[model samples]
Target: MKKLFIAALLFVGMVSFAQDAAQPVKQQRERLTPEQRNEKHLKKLTTELNLDTNQQAQVAKLLADRSAKAQKHMEMRKARKDSSIKPTAEEKAALKKEIMDEKTATEAQMKSILNAEQYKKWTAMRDENKEKMKDKMKERKNKL
Candidate 1:
């Protein structure tokens, strides 16, 4: 009777091990093309902002351009990492300044494209996301 109970416990342990081993690993999301990304952004904005056809067209164009620029910037950054050349303080500052300029330009374009109410909502959303990102970074830093 003791031998039989020991055998049952061993069998249960093996079954649990097999079940755990069979579970699939979580996969990251597949990368999207710039145009597809822009389209996705447009859809989200349209849903949130209730954009009209003309506004949609303008926003689509702006999003596509923004996405393209962002993709290029990321590729450039990756290339810089591959080259093993570390940026100096001045270079880092310049890059940051350029990013800020681009952001300011984008915000201006958005304001021109959207009505006052829509722009206000969009800014609010942007601010909220920025805060969330800051919190996430702070948490990550604390973890480190």
Candidate 2:
């Protein structure tokens, strides 16, 4: 009887370990090209804003232009990071001003392209996304 009890315990332990070992590992997400990403974003905006064909075309062009500029900016940031160089306070202020100016210009262009109602909705969506990003950053900080 004791020998049978010992045999059953060993069998259960082996089965649990084997099951864990057989579990699949998590896979990394697939990367999309810049154009593909822009297209996807454009489609989402079209659905959300009920954009007309002409509006869609304009939005697509705007998205593509934004993506290109963002790619360039990211490369610049990466290069700065790689060089381990810290910007002076004046440089930081200039960079901030440039970013704010670009943002204002982009908003102006979007307003020109979208109708009043659409522009309102776009701004609301943008604010919501900003809040979501802030929450995510806070969560990451807490984790650290």
Candidate 3:
């Protein structure tokens, strides 16, 4: 009986070590360059909206501009985060207002660029993505 118990303990230890050894390593993914990302996004939009050459050029330019602005915003945000300073209520309100303004401007630009049907489809896609983001945030909150 003592011999059997010792063998069972040894088996459990080996199984635990085997499970740990079999676990997969997480790999770091290569990120695309900004230009490459922009081009890929443009191609997707072209395919989805059936954009003409002229529209494609315009959209590409628009995307590049938007990307630049977003990059700048991200840098500023990172700097603020690094500073470790909490924003005041008024500052938070101002930042929220600025984001809303940018959002409205982008929507207006999209409406100008796309035809009625394309704009409608684009809005639908945007809303769907927004919902997905909200769901993801909720899931993260729940997890935490």
Instruction: Point to the candidate with the largest TM-score.
Output: 2
Please give the lDDT score at residue 4 for candidate 1.
26
For model 2, where is the 10-residue window of minimal lDDT?
A: 1-10
lDDT of 3 by residue, 5-122 (tens): 3334445544555667556544534667768878998998899899889889988988887777767766766688899988889988897787778778878988899999999988
lDDT of 1 by residue, 17-133 (tens): 566755654453566666776788799999999999999999998887776676677677678989989889999999788878878888999999999999999999888976875
Model 1 segments more than 4 A misplaced:
1-24, 142-144
Q: Candidate 2 has what TM-score? A: 0.77
Colliding pairs, model 1: none
Model 3 deviation from native, Cα RMSD in Å = 15.0
* Candidates in descending TM-score order: 2, 1, 3
Overall local distance difference test of candidate 1: 0.75
What's the count of clashing pairs in each model shown?
Answer: 0, 0, 0
lDDT of 3: 0.73
TM for candidate 1 is 0.75
Measured with C-alpha atoms, the lDDT of residue 106 in candidate 3 is 78
